[model samples]
Target: MRHLLAALFLALSTVAAAQQAPRIAVTDLAYEEQVARYFQYTRFQGKSSHRESERYADSDYSSRGSARSSGRTEIDYESISGDIVYIDRGELRKFTADIKGEMLKSGVYRVVQAKPYTAKDNEKLYDVIDRIKKGYFPNADYVLFGSITSVEPRRELNPIQGSDAISASLSMELVAEFSLIDTKTYEVKAAFSAMGEGQDMRLLKDPGQVAHLSRGKVMREVAQSLGVDVATQLEEQFNPGAARRARGDRYREETIERREERIIEYR
Candidate 1:
């Protein structure tokens, strides 16, 4: 009876271990910088300027003697000025600033306000991954990390009319490249590139507005790609029975023996 009880306890322990959920560490996604350029109208040079001025002249005379008295009348002149307005560069700058702010606030991707990473900064990618893993999943079975490999921006010119006259407009295209790595095997898991484009509407202005629009679009694409890749990786590493147990599936007495048999077969 003592030996039989010991064996039963051992079996229970094995079953418990097999039902434990596998831990996976998902590192922060890395992405390349994306740029978009658009022409924003800043100032209009042909607008009219106006000024107004007023003038007054007056004269008065008086007699010294009380018997004789004299009075003089005075006249004044006044003027007002007005002018029609034209488009200017200031308008373009304001519009561009508005667009840029909107894009940054959209939160489609992690936007970097500063200059992009240099070749020397490439090491930071691995460092970030390692730090995240250490903090979130010290004993995790799998760690996924990646980095931004490249970013290229190309601009094309178009022509449009401004308040002053015809001006050159710009359209920008951005390309981004990313690479995924497996921490355990030190192997590259996936690599891909994405591109997005934006057009500037203000022909007589700054190009920053359209650039932001393009960046936002690219960010959305990057996120979708990352989701698909991560899903695939998880599927590959998943253990079916562990997943079911983690999801709160109960084991039946009859199926318990079959499950044990399958686990043994897989092991």
Candidate 2:
């Protein structure tokens, strides 16, 4: 009888604990790549300037005439202009997948899938506010909003010292900002920026050999690291005074500043 009572209490306790976990709806990471293009087009003017003249002279013996002399010139002009372009890379699923997995693994929060808000015009909605209002994340207590602040990839090739082989390296960096917002109050509970970077290098033995860098590997590494970073920060920010007292705060702040830059200005 006592065993049955204890088992009932234990089951109830487990149920209560499960219900106490915060339910979070994590949306895919939003990213927008702005591409500014400068173009120059050379147009053939199809214009020709011609000069023609004829001279005739009459002398005592006979009349002498000179034929017409003609000259032509062609001109071409160049037109240069630029345009600001925006590319909407709907949702970065790779990063979001990793982040959601990490959060789930942590067991701190109950992670839920957030659906996309399908607008009537078929335009994609990247904003969390619109998604929440449209009932994308149903029954979620809070929404985890993420956006890609910046992504940079670099490649370099240089001669190795004291060797005939060339060293080729490829590196990728990703920065994203995350915010946990209360669904009812629409207040931001925690907000922070996270970054991840990865690199790969290889030595080319043959001079004419093509060096292929493992771009996918590098990006996967970045995504994994970014996921861990986001989960760690989320946990830290939720704890009172944890983020402020953390030793990595200064470094994170500096990274956040370096990764974000304003390129467009509107008057």
Candidate 3:
């Protein structure tokens, strides 16, 4: 009977603790990739050459010859170059999902969905501040802003020093920055940068086999790593000691007050 009562009390306490956790809204991951294009157009120019010679013979005049020649040549050419920004909304969503999943799993903060921003067809970037100003995270106490800084992938092949084999490697790296800001005050509570990497390697005796690298797997891993880093940093920057104290004080005050009201109602 004592054990059962204890278990029941513990369950209620756990629920109360979860309810006290701060609610945070995560925004879409912002990223942009620039692709430069060089275009050239060539057209043939219609040109003609003409030559004329005339010789007139007179009964007793010496032979005379005259020649005229004219030529024209032209080549039409044009070059156009510019950079275009490529935004993959689906990929960015996946990356944000990974971070959100990690944050949820950590249980450091309750996750809330931020209202999606409507973007125009030609828009290439999402602004976090504008979203906040527009009340995108109305229910959240804080907004978590994230952006991808850089992504780099490298592949290389090398011959073994003492053997006829060859070694191949593919490496992928991703870096991102994150900030936690108060929803009302707009003050940045915590900010930091994190990086994730994945590598695939293989050795072949024939040296002719194609090395296959898993890009999706690498990207997923990188995203998950970034999520973990974000969550861990949030916890550390807030200071666990202060958080625990705040939780304890709130729990005591709220629970005791509720209990007193219950007793009065029963009487």
Q: How does each model score on lDDT?
A: 0.40, 0.76, 0.72
Q: What's the CA error at residue 67 for candidate 1, in Å? A: 96
Question: What local lDDT does model 2 show for residue 4?
Answer: 57
For every model shown, the clashing-pair count is 15, 0, 0
For candidate 2, list the clashing residue pairs, or say none: none
Better of 1 and 2 by lDDT: 2
| TM-score preference between candidates 1 and 2, better one | 2
Model 3 CA deviation exceeding 4 Å by range: 1-12, 33-35, 39-91, 121-126, 239-242, 245-267
- Candidate 3 C-alpha lDDT tens digits along 1-267: 345544555576667657876788987776666655555555555555666666666566577666666666756555555555454541266577877887778666788988766556325345556677777788898888877888899888989999999888887888878888888787888898878777777887885688777777777777777777877887778533346656666765666667778878999
TM-score ranking of the models: 3, 2, 1
TM-score of 2: 0.65
Candidate 1 local lDDT, 112-217, one digit each (tens): 2211223244435445455444444355444433333443444444545444433433444433343333445545544554344444433435544332335444
TM, every model: 0.29, 0.65, 0.67
TM-score of 1: 0.29
The most accurate candidate by lDDT is 2
